[model samples]
Target: MSFANCGLPYHIGGDIKDRSKLLLQTPESFLARFNVDVRVMNEVVSINRADKTVTIKNLIDGSKYTESYDFLLLSPGAAPFIPAIAGIDNPLTHSLRNIPDMDRIIQTIQTNKPKHATVVGGGFIGLEMMEHSTNLV
Candidate 1:
């Protein structure tokens, strides 16, 4: 997620049109290069702070596992934050959170061809999310 949205800012800067270079680090590269061990598609269902342990499961597979950590970093830059609309979910709305959400937004736009999208929150993250939809940016 950190390096995935790299190309969107360029839209604001008017640098490039497409954003293929933004998604440079795959799960393997993020893990191997940074030594961060990025467990792709994994959900942290529970966190035991006292024990310094984290419980996770892969979204693709139902396998469960636990990891011990000396310290934890919580930097989920975005989440599916809806504004309590009457029928927001009915019209296929979304927010940027992870790699899967990016894919979903891309696929939805490709299949539905959405036009005149109304992005609610106006901030850094909202800008990033909206800028990314421009030709799969």
Candidate 2:
């Protein structure tokens, strides 16, 4: 399932309340409604523009294959800017990006029960996190 990624921070801070509400679409729904074959766990490793083909990697089974396409749409999403700093690799340090990252952050808050938290970025999402983190205190 693909989620409304912008709502991830709100979901973390209890503003979203319902986790399922974040899910925006499913592969089956896309296939049924739009006839789009949404391959969830497949990654396009390489694109051959000359031949109009793409090399796909199955993330789950570690298999690789190529598929020819009339038109290719590249929709790789953004990643957080993790600065190179001391102790940045520590398990406590987390970046909010995808569903797994959000899950880890939530699990850390619940299981570790830390008294304090640090938000790195000062963008809109960062401010939302800071406000929500304070509310959780």
Most accurate candidate by TM-score:
2
Kindly list the per-residue Cα lDDT of model 2 for residues 1-137, writing each as its tens digit: 68887888888888999988988889999899999888988989999999999999999998999999998777786788889989999998898877888899899988988899988889988887888897566
List TM-scores for all candidates, in order: 0.58, 0.89
The global C-alpha lDDT for each of the candidates, from Candidate 1 onward, is 0.68, 0.87
TM-score of 1: 0.58
Clashes of 1: 0
Tens-digit lDDT track for model 1 on 42-109?
Answer: 99888899999999987898988999989998865555567887888774787765546656766676
lDDT of 1: 0.68
Please give the TM-score that candidate 2 achieves against the real structure: 0.89
